[model samples]
Target: MKLPEINTATPYAGLSPDLVLDAVSHCGLWPDGRLLALNSYENRVWQVGLEETAPVIAKFYRPGRWSDAAIEEEHAFALELAAAELPVVAPLVFDGQTLRQHEGFRYALTPRRGGRAPSLESTTQLEWLGRLIARIHSVGSRQPFVHRGRVDRATLMQAPMQAVLASTLLPASLQANYRSAAQRLDDAVAMRLEAIGPVRQLRLHGDCHPGNVLWTDEGPHFVDLDDARMGPAVQDLWMLAGDERALNALLDGYTQMREFDDTERALIPALRAMRQMHYAGWIAARWHDPAFPAAFPFAAESRWWEQHIADLHELADGL
Candidate 1:
């Protein structure tokens, strides 16, 4: 039987077990054939066991998503953080090269670091996380990315809104309403950002949610700098805190390590608004990919779109 051509857009479509093992072996490692897929939607990652050795992780980059320069910048940043004794899991340098190509897939290998989600309920944990993030930001401020992108309204809000509008997922009935709400919300977010004035932009772990952080007896270790980009320091700090008290605890720890710009606090609402629209747009853009629908079944439902529109309107009002 003949199979379909998955191509670049569907990079993981042809990633069979045999191909995965081959990719690992091509890296000069002996694969024991025990493979476990990790939780990652943007890229394909696996834990490959070795013969009489500790298992290592293999991450296959999504084709056409990032240029070689951008990916190299990310690798360099990870190595910088690691050199400072930070807990970031840097890619393994085999034959003096971290990035490698095998079977037409670009990939990197790393030692498998283990830990569970950090307990955000504890003040101590939150503070510790804050200090680590501040350290990260300090290093991030020392340099800038030439080939990498930046986190801004254009990529996070305007572009995403345009993509979602172009997608067929939005019901015709709610399409007009969504357009109006999204536009209004975009305007509101713009005004809010303007009020915050000129904030400093530093390289950040753009998607610094709880899932990217792992906790162990030692402390927190950040993983998946895949979304790393130039952005405000607050962008890394906001997602980890739920309330003012939590924010205070985090800032307290952060300030101890580095100066925290209090003015950046005002941009949180605007950032939140962008996140909502960006998420919807991300789902819409990737709807053609099989993983998206299974993960976001609600995107197909009209009711969900209605709620999303309503939520956008409410967020706009608050902003």
Candidate 2:
């Protein structure tokens, strides 16, 4: 079967090595040709060694993903966090702008930062991470995003489900079952949000899973704010803790810096449900990209759909 047409093949199909080198030079930096592709699926990122300076990370934003305004808002947010002496990797100000462009691609250059993945198993570590996130949230709440989006059901649940249904990836035999399960999940998520009415929405690190945080001897610092959005503070905290103990530890550290709304804890299950649906939709929408097939081979199998439907039903049952 011919795969569905994707807008562009994985957003980096034409990002050749020389193109990256020229982009660096356009920014007035001399490249040493020692380029290492970083592990990023949403955008193309590379660590390029410089001629007379240390290596720097070049992130080429995926076309059609975020408008230039939204991306600049992200860059400004990072710079704001850094100005507060928070451990965040902000983009370098080249010429006069943090956002730069080259050969039809919008990109930014950040000084290469090195650190190991954080160990979430330690309570102390969790607490430390909690404090940092709280600090981020504190800054995030100070102002609202003019261009970035929010973490809500319309974008998270409805859009993803629509994409999956429109795609050819779902088998004809399983489509009905998947649709029913997903619709039920959508209803449950809506009800959950209604029950937790009027939670405070603030600027958030929208995707705060451990992978986004880099840890060194000094402490933890966030590396990616690409998913930043306006949402409840808990949206940043819930993903850090799987169990009550860990959650409490994270909260323990967070409270030390800023007051957290305990009521937001109730929104965790709802947020998780939305994420589960959003992930499947994201995969379906990107299935036409070559990288999607290689990284998500299971998505092509009937067994995966079976599990996915069942999981959706389980989420509905809980809600």
Candidate 3:
């Protein structure tokens, strides 16, 4: 089922303050009219205050971005990880449903989890995160998502490259340059993946960047499984590893719970290149959304595009 496209410039225009309060109330929660917008561009997330209870997080899924089944699958994966005693924030089930709709919006409520960013410089922290991720993957490997996507050249690079090319955000004068650089990077990534051959693909947190990890005195807990999908285990590992030392630290903890595939290490550069291309393409595709331009003002600058093209070539050359 497709949701009606609202104003392209502000897709969440209809998601007004009143609508959010009412949506939370519909789920049997008493929102105290206090709403704080979270840092999210892909979805409209809010910290809704309650009268007698602590604040709860309300995440309104981006319209038309994912099918109901795909969203439900993500919710299920989060729940599975949480159930396995992993540090994950799963959507709170309301009236036996994790995914709900109020008006035209599909939304979910999760208990608010607060913590600061994980310190990547701390080997102890990285090892703890490694263990957490390994445990999450242990559950992830047990089942495959039937509705979500997979991490691959098509989804991560090619389609996004097409989106960038179609977007008017990239200056027309630099379009040819951007395309050529993107294609070279794409080819390099493809060759690397082909050389790596088939590696074990499994369910992953998908976007395990440091921002998604909340570190506390206890250690770290992961948030945001929105990007969860089938992918190499390395996809989850590479983003968190900044260097060889960090990678070794992560693998040291990872092997405690699950076996690490040495072959997947070779896919890191390819994965990194795909992510770089995907990020630029994402901004281009979402340029119509006011949030994108406001959050990423540099993306509109020609210099940024030129630099991005140069970076793409550099990444390809490195591979």
lDDT of prediction 3: 0.91
Model 2: runs farther than 4 Å from truth?
1-10
Over 4 Å off in model 1, which ranges? 1-6
**What digit string (tens of lDDT, one per residue) describes model 2 on residues 1-319?**
3322334655667779999999999999999999999988788899999998999999988888898899999999999999999999999998789998776788999998888888878999999988998999989989999899999999899999999999888888999999999999999888888887988888988999988888889988888899999999999988889899999999999999999989888899989999999999999998877778898999989899899999999999988
Query: For residues 1-319, could you state the per-residue lDDT of candidate 1 as single tens digits?
Result: 3333448556688888899899889888999999999877778899999998999999998877788889989999999999988889999998888898876778899999999998888899999999999999999999998877887789888888888889889988887899899999999998888877898988898889999999989888999999999989999988999888888989989999999989999989988898999999988887877888898899999999999999999999999
What clash pairs does model 3 have?
A: none
After best superposition, candidate 1 residue 57: deviation in angstroms?
1.3
Models ranked on lDDT: 3, 2, 1
Candidate 1 — which pairs collide?
A: none
Query: TM-score for all predictions?
Result: 0.96, 0.96, 0.97
Each prediction's RMSD to truth: 2.7, 3.8, 1.4
| Candidate 3, superposed: residue stretches over 4 Å from native | 1-9
